[model samples]
Target: MLELLSYDFMQRSLLAAALVGALCSVIGVFVVLRGLAFVGAGTAHAAFAGVALAYLIGFPPLPLAILFGLATVWVTGVMEEQGRMKLDVSIGILYTATMALAILFIGLMKTYNAEVYGYLFGSVLSVTSEELHIILVLSVLVLGLIVLFSKELYFIAFDQEMAEASGVPARRMYYLLLTLIALTMVVSLKTVGAILVFAMVLIPASTAYQLTHSLRHMTAYAAVIGTTSAVGGVLLSYAWDVPTGPAIVLLATAVFFGSVLFSPKRLRRIVA
Candidate 1:
């Protein structure tokens, strides 16, 4: 482990992974409570589509990815809030369309772009210094906002109607949550990739949920679980020379299952 930290790229990769892991799990607390799992997944694919378009048109990938991801969640939030359509149905359509767009953009490129594929499948060990800086900046921004509005976000997540009844501007807060979800997806795209990023958000929170009924404890546990999985996966990947993305995700998955097997909540249910 000490030897791995001796290298610059590995250091950047570990930092990026830890940031992504912590950010995703923190925001994931709300996502799990609000039942935004599908929407979160859709935003990731939309962000990936934007990355593809950016690579094809020679635009900066970050801006376009943010645009597409935000558009997806905003549109989904509007449709769901306005009662125009079911949230899942709207996001489902956008999800399919965005994935198709991603494939189309990739196909249109005359020559293959390996960097583009990095965003698709993730290669955390390849994280550049610039990319690490971007991740750090965005992670701080998103986490800061979540901390600022944690109460309203949590209130609405538990019961939007009740929150609105209490004058919390539930609609706006819902949009804010969706926006945060979109940004979180974009922030995590490179480290975990579009395909598996949602799992990074979902799994740790879910695992934590099984262990505690308290939101604060759940979030804290998730952060620890996520960070551990990410750093552990990086070490294992370095040792085994396997892909880092899947390694992190699979390690998180294993932790999730372990949590499930031994969860106090589950054991209480069994004893009862």
Candidate 2:
């Protein structure tokens, strides 16, 4: 296991996992709090469409995926605000449309591209140095934005009406939060893939949610859990010759179940 670091690809994969894990879990706190887990899933599938579109048009997939994800979330937010549809319904519509687009684009290709499979199921072991750099830069950007807007985000997450009453710019903050989630999804694409990325976003934060009521504590705990799962999964994948994304998600699920079984909050509620 120690000797695996000697390989450059292994080093990149570990770094990618750690960064993606931490960022996804941090954003996931808000996702879990707002009941927007479906949003994450929607954005990830939308990004898959973007990836397929990029492949079709001969462009870089990450940037295009980011655009696609942001567009999807923005549309969802707009529809919800306009009272045109419920958020979940809007998300479901976009999710299916984008997934269909991805399928169509892939089908149109003259030859099957194995790389697309990597995006679908993850290929962290094949992470390139450039991809690692992008992940690092985006992780820093996402974390910084979160810190800068911590109070507003907290207010909006817990009580949007109250936040708006308090002049917290709730609507703007809502869109901003969605945008951040989209960006995080894009950055996480390679490490966890489109299909499994929502697990990274949901499981860690959900686990943390079971353990704590404080948003700060929840975020911190989620980050730690996400990081641990990602690193541990990578190691297990290496040892077992399994797919890295599912390995990471399974570890996260295990942690969540563990938290559910022994959560102090749950125990306190029961005892009371």
Candidate 3:
């Protein structure tokens, strides 16, 4: 482990994993509370389309992912407003459609490259300093926004009707959260890929929820669990030469089950 840290790429991978894990878990609390798990999966698939587009056009993947993800966010919000599409249905269609398009684009590109598969499953060891900077900046921005709007978010999450009755901008907050989720999806793509991205965004928070009723406690615990899972997964994967993304998600799943098995909240509820 000490030898691993001595290498620049391993250090970068660890840093990226920590940042991505923290962001995913923090935001994932709201996602789980609001039942937006499907939306996270959809946004990840949309990000895959963005990456495919970027690869086909000879551009970087990150900006393209953000662009496509934000567009999907806006469109989904509009669909919700119009009462034209339920979230799960909309998300399902969007996810499959984008994934199909991404696959098609990859096939049409006429070149098979290892980087594509790396992006699909993750290649954190290949993360560059610039990518790290972007992840850091985005993580800070997302955390700050989440902090500033914690009250509103909590209200919106727990009681949308009450929040709106109390003059909270429910629609606005909904869109804001989706936009942030979109950004989260984009940044997380390089770490975990679209296929398993939602695991990072949902499992830790769900586990935390099992352990606590307070949003503050949930967020804190989720972040800790997520970071630990990511780091541990990376270390184990490095040692065993397994694929990183699924390994990380498997670690998160282990944590989720551990929390469920030992949750004081569950014990109290049972006793009550």
Candidate 4:
């Protein structure tokens, strides 16, 4: 592992995984608690569309994806706030539409690019220093927001009415949280791919959920689990010449299932 880190590509991959893991786990706690897992998937697909558009237009893909992701969050938040449409319906429609557009653009480009496939399935080994820098910045932004607003965010998460009653600007926090999720999805897309981004966002936090009843401790445990799984998966992929995204997700799934199998709650229920 030490020798592998000496290589620039490997170092970049590790750094990307570390940052992505932290971001995903942090945002995932809210995603799970708020029942917004679908939103994460939607934003991920939306980001993919942005990448495809970037490819067609000859711009940097990550930045384009992030921009698209932010837009998606805004639109979805507006629709949700208006209550003119159900949140799931809005997300499903937009998610499919954007993903379809991405596919169309990819075909129109008339190039079967390995880089495109790598993004779909992850080539963390191919992560550029520039991309890693973007991930680092985004991670800081996310952590900063979470730290600054954790009390209010938690109140909103637990009881939106109470949060609003307390002058927490719950709506603003809601949109802000969505925006953070968009950023998190965009950053993790390269490491875990759009298809498996949900795994990264949900698995570690779910496992932590099983281990703890406290939100703070659960968040900490989730971050640790996510980072460990990402790094381990990447190392395993490197050693075995396997795909990185699936490997990482599989590791997360393993942890999730392990938690379910061994959860004390389940055991107590069984005994009763």
Candidate 5:
């Protein structure tokens, strides 16, 4: 295992996994808290449409996908606020429409590209140094934004009405949170791909929720769980010659179920 670190690609893969894991887990806490898991899923699929568009148009996918994801969020927010549609309803409609667009784009291609498949399912081992740099920069930006707005975000996540009453600009903070989620999804797309990115966003946070009520502790625990799953999955995928994205998601899922089995909250409820 230690010998693998000598290889540059392996080292980069591990580092990328750690960055993505920590970033996704942290953002996921808010997603879980705000009951926005569906939104996360929808945004990821919308980004998938962007990826397909990139492939079709011969442009870089990540930036385009980021734009697409952000646009999806903006549309959802607008529909909910101005068009008088529920968020879930807007998300569901947009999610399906974007997925249909992705399929349509795929069909339009005259010849299938294997690289596009990697975007669908992830190709972390193939990540280049430049791509890693992009991930690092974006990860730092996401973390910094989270730190700067931590209090406001926490207030909004737990009690939007109260936060708004307190003049916290709850609506704007919510949009910022969505932007962070979009950026995180774009950075993570190469590691876990569009299909499984939401699992990376969701599972570790859900696992931590089972173990703690404190937001601080939950965020920390989720990061640890996510990093562990990412590293472990990368190692397992290398050893077993399996797909890395699914491997990471499966490990995260295992941790979530394990947490459920031994959760103190579950035990307390049972005893009560």
Candidate 6:
């Protein structure tokens, strides 16, 4: 393990995994509280579609991914807010459409693209120094914005209607949450891949929920769990010669089940 850390690429991979994991888990708190799990999955597919198109066109994938992810979430939010369609319905439609788009884009490519598959299944062990810097900058920006708007975000997450009643700009805050989620997904695409990134976002936060009811404490616990999972996953994957993304997610899943088994709420229920 110590020998692994001496390698520059391993250091970069660990740093990238930690940043991506922390960012995903923190944003995931609001996502879980707001009941937007489906949105996470949907935006991932949309972002992947953008990546596919970018590869086909010989363009950068990051901006295109951000564009697609943001578009999907905003459209879903608008539909739900306008009562035009239920949130799940809109997300369900977009989810399938985006995945189909990804497939179509891949089919259009004349040759097999191993690099594109990297984005699909994740290759955190291959993270470059440049990508590490990108991950760091975005992680800081997102985490900072989260701190700046923490109170309002929490308000909207738990009770948007009441927050709006109190003039908290709940609608705008809701959109901001969606935007954050999209950005988080896009930033994490390389490290965790499109298919498994949602697990990175959802699992740590969900596990934290099993341990605490207080929002602040839950967020703190989730960050720790997520970081641990990412770092630990990278280490284990290297040692075992396994996939990094699945390893991270599986570790988090184990923690989640452990939390559930010993949850205070569950114990209280049993006592009663």
Point out where model 5 deviates above 4 Å: none
lDDT per residue as tens, model 1, 88-197: 89999999999999999999999989999899888889999999999999999999999999999999989999999999988888988999999999989999899989
Judged by lDDT against the true structure, how good is candidate 6? 0.93
| TM-score for each model | 0.99, 0.98, 0.96, 0.96, 0.97, 0.99
Per-residue lDDT value at 253 in model 5 = 98
The better candidate by lDDT, 3 or 4, is 3
- Candidate 1: how large is its RMSD? 0.7
TM-score of 3: 0.96
Candidate 4 lDDT over 230-256, as tens digits, reads 988899999999989888889889989
**Local accuracy of candidate 6 as per-residue lDDT tens digits, 5-103:** 999999999999999989999998998999999999999999999999999999998889999999999999999989999899999999999999999
**Model 3 agreement with the true structure over 69-107: per-residue lDDT tens digits:** 888878887887788989778878888888898898798
What clash count does candidate 2 reach? Answer: 0
Worst 10 residues of 1 by lDDT: 226-235
Q: What is the lDDT of candidate 5?
A: 0.91
Worst 10-residue lDDT window for candidate 5 reads: 74-83
Mind giving the per-residue lDDT tens digits that candidate 2 earns over 1-272? 78899989999999999999999999999998888989999999999899998998899998899999999999999998899898899999999999999999999999889888788898999989999999999999999999999999988889999999988899999999999999999998888999999999999999999999888899999999999999999999999999899999998999999999999999999999
lDDT of each: 0.93, 0.93, 0.88, 0.87, 0.91, 0.93
Indicate the TM-score of model 2. 0.98
For residue 213, give model 3's deviation from the true position in Å.
Answer: 1.4
RMSD of each: 0.7, 0.8, 1.2, 1.3, 1.1, 0.7
lDDT of 5 by residue, 161-222 (tens): 89999899999999999899888888888899888999999999999999998999999999
